[model samples]
Target: MYFVKKSIVIVIGSILISLGINLFLVPYKVLDGGIIGIGLILNYLWGLKAGLTIIVLSIPIFIIAWVSYRDYFYNSLHGMIISSLFIDFLKTNDSLFLINPVYSSILGGVLVGSGIGLMLRFRTSTGGTDLIAQFLCDKTGINVGILIFFIDSFVILLGGILLSTDTLFLSVITIMFVALTTSLFTRNVVQA
Candidate 1:
């Protein structure tokens, strides 16, 4: 029963995340944090598929998780695969609605953050840096939320340097919302 519930949550979360990226962030070229951010960068710079890029970039992290954090690997593998596929599939769809870039950033952040938080609450995640964050949190006794925020900020900074200042600012706003919403939802849930 627990397994079934978790699976359902993960699928729903993945769908929400895919919708956020495709309908809001991708249209504005706004980036999310972690592997998604890297994927977005690849998409903007080289016209690569963001979902494919996410899977490719996450390989090393997943490898690390498999070796050192077997439980996390098991928990997150499905989430990663499902979410990546959904992201790629949804990217091809037309935008659900058009809005200002700022509004898009906020809305995208909310959707992505809520999806991520819900999965995290269920002891699952989209993997990638999230796995690393969980591992580090376990080892260092740091709050996962804070660690995630730091990692996200670093990625956003890199995006700023590699992309544009406008992207930086907008992405910062998006990530702030992501971090806040994620923290709110994951507050009472189990830590990875």
Candidate 2:
């Protein structure tokens, strides 16, 4: 029963993430943190696909997890692969959401946050920011969420400096939404 429930959650979570990427973030040109954010920034600079970049970037993070944290690697591998595939596949459907640029940031934030929360609830992660967060937590005994925020915050700030003001503001809003939605979704999840 637990396995079934977890599988369902992963599916739904991945859908939310893909929706956030294709419908909200990608269309509006908003950025988040982690590998995805970097991918978006690169896309802005180099005209690359953010989804494909995320998948490729995740390879190194996965390699690190596999070598340094076998348990985390085992747990997050499926989610990382599925979410990456879904994000890339859903690009063709970008017009479905029909949201404005600002709304896109908010919606994307909520979706991404909730997705990550659900994955974390199941003891899984998408293995971009989470991998780094886990490494920090393991090494420093600080909360993973806080560490994630700190790291992402730096990226967002850099994005602000490098990009437009709108992108910077949207990134902040998106991160806030991600944090809120993740907390709301995983409020009752137990950590093992």
Candidate 1 ranges beyond 4 A from true positions? none
| True-structure Cα RMSD, model 1 | 1.4
Q: Each prediction's Cα lDDT score?
A: 0.87, 0.79
Clashing pairs in 2: none
lDDT of predicted model 1: 0.87
Pick by lDDT: which candidate is best?
1
Q: Residue by residue across 40-119, what tens digits does model 2's lDDT show? A: 78877788877778889888888888888888998888887788778777776337777677888999998888888888
Number of backbone collisions per candidate: 0, 0
Clashing residue pairs, backbone N/CA/C < 3 A, model 1: none
Q: Which predicted model would earn the best TM-score?
A: 1
What does candidate 1's lDDT look like per residue over 33-71, in tens digits? 999898998998899989989999989988988998889
